[model samples]
Target: MTTLKKTGARLGTLPLAVMVLLAAGCGTQQAGDTVKAYRRSYPTPSTPADFLCPGEDPEPTAATAAATAPSATVPPTDHYAENHGFRVPIPLHGQNRCDGLTVTERVKSALEPLRKRGDFAPQHVQNVLTDLGYPAGKVYQDGPTGVGFLIVIDASPWCVEGTMSRDSTKADAFGGYPDGTGCEPPQGGH
Candidate 1:
């Protein structure tokens, strides 16, 4: 029974000594030393504006200016003036000079010479003319190479046929006529 009491007293003294050693190891002075070491390693950020402002910008940057810049302006098309000139200045109406049968007959007539000269075939010329909106009611015939027309209904003029020739390999096989120049009328009006 005396040995048991001695053992209990030793155990109580052991817990008290352990608590004192723990308190000394984790003392306020030790905590203060830790705080001072932390301050030296990483101080609280002073004057937070140093992080906020890198430097005063002399002028707005490209990124900033682009965000604030005005939108671009698109230019107007010249088609309206071009169409007016085609109609008013260079009238393309009434009987075509090449053949009497409007623009359609004129194309057929023009193709006759070219076909004979082997520059174009009949069927090819017909197909090309059909694709180009043939029988143009408003006549605007010139040389086969320069033949152009405006539809009776529309303002836009189209060069329907003979703007190019197989004979063009040699310079001016069509009687040395300048490109897009008018040809002299054939004798006896054929």
Candidate 2:
């Protein structure tokens, strides 16, 4: 079609004309300036992540040091989680927003006292939730990212979860898991 040919021709040349105008707008050293602008806009991965935040302990934890100790009786345990009780499986619920806010507030109140502990750590979260009448089997615990549990306090579909940062902590309720139970995200990678 004549119209299609006209449109295709415009599309091909439009970009070239715009590029020429843009380069002309550059005051001097057009190619170098464009290259520098592009480089600044799209930074390359010049350095690998160290994973250590500033002011954090550059040294590893005591457990890690013990694992590498020259006097170790055996190699470090491969099933590190067997003794730690890290991932406690729980019933999961799918996403729902109906009762999230109310159940979330309950979770917040329950965590208030524990949060007051000057020495609060992730490990304490599971025990505290269990003491608050949440079903022990229904409470799930993961590593430093705090714990998650179903809102069994009332008829609600929400999972109360907590998270911590170097400077602060937070708790909120989210819609249940993918399979539709109010527990930690399915398969449990925080």
Candidate 3:
């Protein structure tokens, strides 16, 4: 075969290669790395978590601090992505706002039924989220990276981000990000 044809054939298997790598990397979640403990580790400035909230820094007690100013130092037991491949500038958020944990469940469940249809087009996903009570205008989407895409709903108090992957066969939804707008991953604090 010509060099060009050989290169094309190799490229065709790129997706498969990526899938294999990803599968292997996602071994198993650690016991302590449960979603309940997946705290937001973002907004870490020289002054520790002083830049925690974007606006109106609340005087946090031990009770409310868990929801408001979560630890930016302690990481979840499973730092799989960091060790495996992906390196995020900001940390992942937890389900604490706008009833985020519930919303995340709702979004994940809503997508599950539609997964078999293979109709996870951006607009469709947004519409579905809107139907579930979120604003249509606040939703954001990016990419069909291999067989996946990202969806983040600006659920006001928190950003509910969902990553649809492996040709819509699976999805992982979570809450929060340390963005200035309390939504989207634009980098930096609050």
Candidate 4:
């Protein structure tokens, strides 16, 4: 009776071990299938054959050189000055005119009153210029540099000029002054 009981216990443990082994084999097969499916869904990316390494200079082709060449049809104009990196003001008048007063005088009259106030807003200066018949744009506030409020005016020919800095007491104008030299300001205050 003791021998039979020991054999029965061993037989029960053998079936459990076989079931665990079969489950492990099934799990391995599922994992392998999942890996195969993922690989099929997303293929590996390929590098371009003509890719250049860092600091490698490529030889310019004839087509690229021709495309970069300057065109002869374009006439040389003072467009560079007009479209400078800094924002420029728009002209009050459609074209350059020497009518009432010069741009300098107009700007001075507009800004002096505001400057006397001792630290007025930039909008106030812009309004003064607009009210004085000179439309102002690109108003910049001086940050840490103590440069003050800088205003730009599209005053051509008569002044081809604008203000560089406008503080609490004064405003500084730049571009051709006194005689309006170094300016071709008839077409859009260039």
Candidate 5:
């Protein structure tokens, strides 16, 4: 068959334009839609408290401080425990608040979840210390990277009081880890 010459039809750009328009339309979301989508994506975290950034010092709030403060009469258990990822060490001053039995048991319990979480192993060096025994009068505080607390054994000269800072209530200053770098404890005059 002979070819029909001379029809020079122009190609339509409509298909390409439609694709661009569809992309532009879907690119941005409305503010409410964004919020809705965020909620859907994140859901609610299991423990909001656990996720809170251990702000500057990571000290417990006043109420918790009071509860943790050692009293003249030691409780049967002076133990301290937490789900061990890295913990703000119990300050040297706060050491008195923990009864050996309580401290040890609490440490065991605290480490249980951490063990489950696969954080520091229950058999790690720190865990071993607690397992063997914590010196009765020693002090401890978080290590430099602040990943873990360092334990001061036997109330040595290296021993110093935990840093003290004002309480919002003006109830009196409370003890805490001094800010520091490395394995050294925060320096505070006892």
Candidate 6:
């Protein structure tokens, strides 16, 4: 009877151990999925042709763009700052091109110094954008590669995109880039 009781206790622990292992596996899978989705949503820029900023001439050729743009290796990560911390109210209507351009420029200027230093602080970036009267939205950082920073401005009816790379020392802005697309509100609607 003593031997049987010990065997039963061991069996009960086996199920608990299995459950823990399953939970851990699920967490790992979920993290991988999140990283994959982020990469899909915001692809890594290969050349200047892949991105455009206001007042910049279009790339003459893909080859030329690739040759001119500096190359930086960005790593994949499960961590990201999306819809966290700061929240901007979504406007009733979409923003115009001019508004987009204005916010883009402000973001570019704010991040210029950080690019030079080859360091990016998410909170500082957020504050600068918010102070500039622009919806900071969400900022995503790819570890510490200094590959650059991606700022998604989803301020109702308008979602402007901005990217900067410490390696390239360039800040590119996309005003009203996702205008027609069905981009959900960044603030989850006010």
Index of the highest-TM-score prediction? 3
Instruction: Report the lDDT tens digits of candidate 1 across residue range 63-166.
Output: 73443232112232566543333122121222221121134344555555654565443345545455555543323333554333322312223222233253
Top lDDT: which candidate number?
6
How many clashes show up in model 4?
0
For each candidate, give its TM-score against the true structure.
Answer: 0.22, 0.33, 0.40, 0.30, 0.25, 0.37
Q: Lowest summed lDDT over 10 consecutive residues: which window, candidate 6?
A: 85-94
Runs in model 6 lying further than 4 Å from the true structure? 1-95, 147-156, 169-190
Residue-level lDDT of model 4, residues 1-190, one tens digit each, is 9999999999999999999988778534576798899899998864222333233236657873443232222354666743542333222222232231245555666667655555456666667766766645445565532223333344443232334243434433333322233322233333
- Model 3 regions lying over 4 Å from their true place: 1-71, 75-98, 137-156, 167-179, 187-190
- lDDT, candidate 6, equals 0.52
How do these models rank on lDDT, best leading?
6, 3, 2, 4, 1, 5
The number of clashing residue pairs in each candidate reads 0, 7, 1, 0, 7, 0
Worst lDDT 10-window in candidate 4: 91-100
Better of 2 and 3 by TM-score: 3
Ranking by TM-score: 3, 6, 2, 4, 5, 1
Q: 83, model 4: CA deviation in Å? A: 20
Better of 1 and 5 by lDDT: 1
Give per-residue CA lDDT, model 5, range 1-190, as digits (tens): 1232322221245666788897777746765997898899997843112222212136678986564454423333424422221223333232332333234344445445443544442135355446656432332333321123334444322221221112110111122333432234344332
lDDT, candidate 2, 134-169, per-residue tens: 654344443453444443444554456654333344
As for lDDT, the candidate ahead, 2 or 3, is: 3
> Cα lDDT for residue 121, model 4?
65
Tell me the TM-score of model 1: 0.22
After superposition of all CA atoms, the RMSD between model 5 and the true structure is: 17.2
